[model samples]
Target: MLKVQEIRELIKLIDHSSIEEFTFEHDGSKIKMKKNTGTSVSVVKTVGQPVEIPSAEVVHKPVVQEVPVEKAATVNAEVIQEKVEIESVTDLHKITSPMVGTFYESPTPDTDAYVKVGSKVSKDSIVCIVEAMKLFNEIEAEVEGEIVEVLVKNGQLVEFGQPLFLVKPE
Candidate 1:
């Protein structure tokens, strides 16, 4: 396996040279790299674990224990950035079922749905009904928001804690 500093130097050398592509192999280890006309270089598939490189639009497993330490740091940074962005946005909240039953969109077959996509709802708004053991239970929104999505279909059987609607809270 190549040292991180060695890999860095090799990458630097590749970037500076006019060579369009290069491949090296030793002691059952291999390194393949290619340069494009654009700023980003393309990484080739390795004989190891799968890696997804969006810039190159290629997927390959990494050579066993060959990926540099920087790869881990880069992945961690991307994940942290994604988490920060998720936290910064107004995330949709889930309205889940309290009991197992069949979901109904309306009180009766002829009536309009109690709530639909884009419908604004209050904490107490009855969004749907759950029928179980001959009992029709009114299920409330429980949160103040606009309904973003209905997760369960009419007459669909739902389990406890199953999300029935996604709400963008006020």
Candidate 2:
């Protein structure tokens, strides 16, 4: 078992890093963490230049104690019928981000958003923009549909494959 303080420290460290996922296992116990992806961790050198570092992990040794033999542990689970109520939800088309970046709802703050709830889009419709490293990339709808939901707010960092909109296909 991990101490609460140790877990807190790890959370804080990961929160400050660009690691998208982390996992640790020891003595039959495991911990997994996933973060909203965006930038990467960088180190500053004497030249005052930033050098990006690849994601890395740190592992700690596990403590163990011998115990007397006993009956094997048994696991129990109960499965209830999940809300099968919305088969229609699976029919909605998802507009996903092509790359990790800052999401933009319009070309500029002064302009109206390209699409909104109930907005009709075509295969070539410019639905939104994604800015990465000062590059503004116009994203297209790629499918004919009516927008049902906008998943992220303007200027929010979006990860690759993150759903940006839900559209009801025309």
Candidate 1 local lDDT, 1-170, one digit each (tens)? 56657878998998875456778776555677777433232344456544444355544545433343335456555655654564466688889999988899999999999999999999999999999999999999889999877877898888899889988899
Candidate 2 vs. true structure, TM-score: 0.52
Q: Give the CA lDDT, 0 to 100, for residue 127 in model 1.
A: 99
Q: Give the runs in model 1 whose Cα sits over 4 Å from its true position.
A: 1-90
> Model 2, range 62-125, lDDT digits (tens) per residue?
3333222222222111111121222247888999999999999999999999999999999999
TM-score of each predicted structure versus truth: 0.48, 0.52
Worst 10 residues of 1 by lDDT: 36-45
The C-alpha lDDT values of all candidates are 0.77, 0.73
Question: Which regions of candidate 2 fall more than 4 Å away from where they truly are?
Answer: 1-88
